[model samples]
Target chain A: MSAHAHSEDDHGSEGHDFAHPMSVQTLLAVFFALTFLTVITVAQASFDFGAFEVATVMFIATIKAVLVMAFFMHMIADKPFNAIIFIGSFVFVGLFVIFTLGDSMMTSGSFEPVVEELAPAVAEPMEVKVDGAP
Target chain B: MSTIEASPEVGHDDHGHDHDHDHPAFLAHHFDTPEQQFDSGKLGIWLFLVTEVLFFSGMFCAYAIFRALRPEVFEGCSQFLNTKLGAINTGVLLFSSLTMAWAVRCSQLEQHKGLVGTLAATLSCAMIFLGVKSIEYSHKWGMGLLPAGLFAYDPSNPHPTDHPNYLMYICIPFAIALAGVLLWLVVSAGLGNKMHVAMAMPLTVVCLCFFVGVGLGMVLESGDETAEHIDVHADPNGLASAPVMLEAEKAAAAEAAPAIAASGAMVSVDESVLEILAGDASNTGVTSGLNALEQQNAAAGTSTITGDEAVVGAITTTEIDVMTPTTAGVFFSIYYCMTGIHAIHILAGIGVLVWLLVRAVRLDFNRQYFGPVDYVGLYWHLVDLIWIYLFPLLYLIR
Candidate 1:
């Protein structure tokens, strides 16, 4: 399919239509959606959702990011290859965060006691002994 | 692959000409068609954007790790961020993205005037973002809400009395640039050079937007401060109660006043000194130490009080809150790292947008060659995308 597209590009005339100019309405709609989502996120911060707070905030942000990537960035009209690789990068990011966070959470119980035991010693001021002063 | 091999042969046939009349000047010699060239550039920018995403993900990972490890710290430090300013900046950036997307559309449609106007508006918004950011940073710096090893935020007195006015220092360079552009505008108008005049006019407005940002920031920040003050005054257990403590300390200090006068020491007691004394009166050891120092100064015939001592004395006497370097400071470290790098990207976007501005002024872009505009637009929107996440993460923590 890409080869067929390339062959057309080889024989295509000058000023061939590839530009996909977004309508002003779409742009304004995206902007308003983003603004509205921003307000929702800010408003949500005032309420406590316990363990779901970060997840909820991130979900709203992801929606805003997708809107930006799709319309403002023209990803909706963009080549499939570009969109695939760009979206694919997030998979790796998810992997990286999940693995490290899981490890940290698993070991956190052991780490807490060590920190508590060492904290008092760390907090105390050190006594300096001067040579030959006594 | 076959088309790629055929393009160079075609280019080789017309290699000696001063201009390739067959192809537009914006079309590169390596690419056979503008569509192909635009496709290649588009792919290249998307890949670059991919790398940018990965690079930023590392910081996001750090944020997730730290917040998971210490959610309470993020909760404590997030209050220091002004949500109103964050919302305003979010709106500014969203509007800039709108202008940027519109600029791309204008370039594609060959609307040169609209193109230039949108680009200039985008640039002005970028400057305003930086301007507001400088206010946020300087305000934090003045309060000593810095990263680890530099955090000195005192919750009792969030605003330190002696911190330098960081906003003035931040604005000095923009002020000079504004002056330079205004002078250029005047000179160009005087010389009747329409092009230079046209250039300088937009440049001057862009520079003025920085100061406008600063003024906007100052107005909002002062309003927040005033609201806080009113809240404190209304609360019976808040800092408003300090004055009652002040009166008691004054009575105690009055008892010690006659002893110093009998010693022939001409000590001048000022309000700030009295406030410091009052603030430290709960600590009897520090109060006695201060009194002894005053008596020693009297015996030495040196009655002058240094401002540094007063500030230091005030800090030591105040109780340190949980928002110190070891606790909430790490959140600020991550905050500065993420947002600081994002601001640098905005600065970079401004540079490239200026380049696009000059090109647009030359009427360089059309339907076939708006790749640069589109590419820069993508980059600009990415910066906005990062801020979308940053605002909620840094400022909107529950």
Candidate 2:
């Protein structure tokens, strides 16, 4: 629970300060996965995804982003609270995006048909009175 | 209490030694341990990546809306963009990401020589990526691909009436590619071993940032011009069928109705009231004249209001007028904004990378302490991912 607990890794007398966190194999595997994802993204773009085009591209990109975050970023091995912080930021941004989309959809254009239909039913007597006066 | 455990002689310096002095090589002061330090760095990068995704979502949203509104126009614009260049840039970025990952591994394993070499390799690939992007950008520029009024100076080269050349779409693609390359270089070489590469890293980063700033500044300003043009078109001059006389009549009616309606109880007015009423009728006469002129123009088929013809074509000519002695289009506006923002982010990424590189070079990192390098690499990769989508959306959507 102490902040100084993580500082234990900084106490070498040799003056060397850098520490390697990942193995060569892990690096190689991540490299291949990233490349594979890139290929897949480009390949997928060529097809007619129509309304799903951006969504599909973004979905694949999200996978690639996750891979980079997990392995290359060392997120997979990090503290649970760190992961929580990362996910929390994502959740906040996600909520912002979803709320914006929902609001935009809901407020789009006007539903004036109901008003139009009810106007005649409610105002017919008034219209007759006005016309008769004229 | 346990005799099985080995007991050491504690009569000497052991009595005065600090337990805290036995810390490992990788931990920073703020973290609980090397693991936690690494964890926090990784967390920071992930959070940063989320912001990036959100930032890029704006462009994707623009692309989606425009595509929905004018799929045919977008598709037509896409046909002019080069897919091959996009694919190549995608390949280059993917490779650079690989070398960046390798550089982190080399640092982790205490392979200083290998780390330096891999960092150099990653840097080289990044430069190559930039070089390729430059070539693509130059081609777009040379071919009048830049946005309207942003140095697209080929007046003699008028676009054919039937098919306007929307080469500016390629601008965003090349800019994204360029930003990707710069971001990679920053991660691998910019932040490797700081002490040895200190001067090199910062200087390279500053220079790259300057270039990116200038390039993107041009892009943003170019977009501003297009927006200005759109605003101009949206103003009074925008609609070709604005009824001047009818507007005058409506103004007069609005003024008179308030006064006359207020005096409804006193219907029997003097000659002054009659004169006022006659003046209002005369204004309506002017409106009728305007209507007659509109009808005459319609009968002659000289008016620009052809119902069957596409509105985009007429808007294109108006855009040309706005961009005349320049270029114009919403596509141009989007192109400049997307590429411009991406470039700025790349410059920032490069600054971090170079700083890490300087540290790596000075033996500041070891087998037990390279979390910064790995996290920097993660940030760099996310920058590249944005370009992957941007390139096709701008250039190869066809």
lDDT tens per residue, model 2, A43-133? 7865667668767777776787677667765667655666676667667656665555455445532111112222221221111000100
TM-score of each prediction: 0.76, 0.55
For residues B80-156, write the lDDT of model 2, one tens digit per residue: 34455456656666676777778787777778867766665555455545544553454445434455334342222
Error of 2 at B1 (Å): 37
lDDT of 1 by residue, B103-211 (tens): 9999999999999999999999999988888978887787677776566655445445466667778889889989998999999999999877777888888899987
Query: What is the two-chain DockQ of model 1?
Result: 0.28
Indicate the worst ten consecutive residues by lDDT in candidate 2 chain A.
Answer: A125-134
Write one digit per residue (lDDT tens) for candidate 1, span A33-73. 99999989988876768779889999999999999999999
Task: Assess each prediction's global lDDT (C-alpha) against the native.
Answer: 0.72, 0.49
Position A53, candidate 1: lDDT: 88
- The candidate that wins on lDDT is 1
Specify the highest-TM-score model's number. Answer: 1
| Residue A36, model 1: Cα distance from true site in angstroms | 1.3
How far off is each candidate at the interface, as Cα RMSD in Å?
Answer: 8.0, 13.9
Candidate 1 docking quality: incorrect, acceptable, medium or high: acceptable
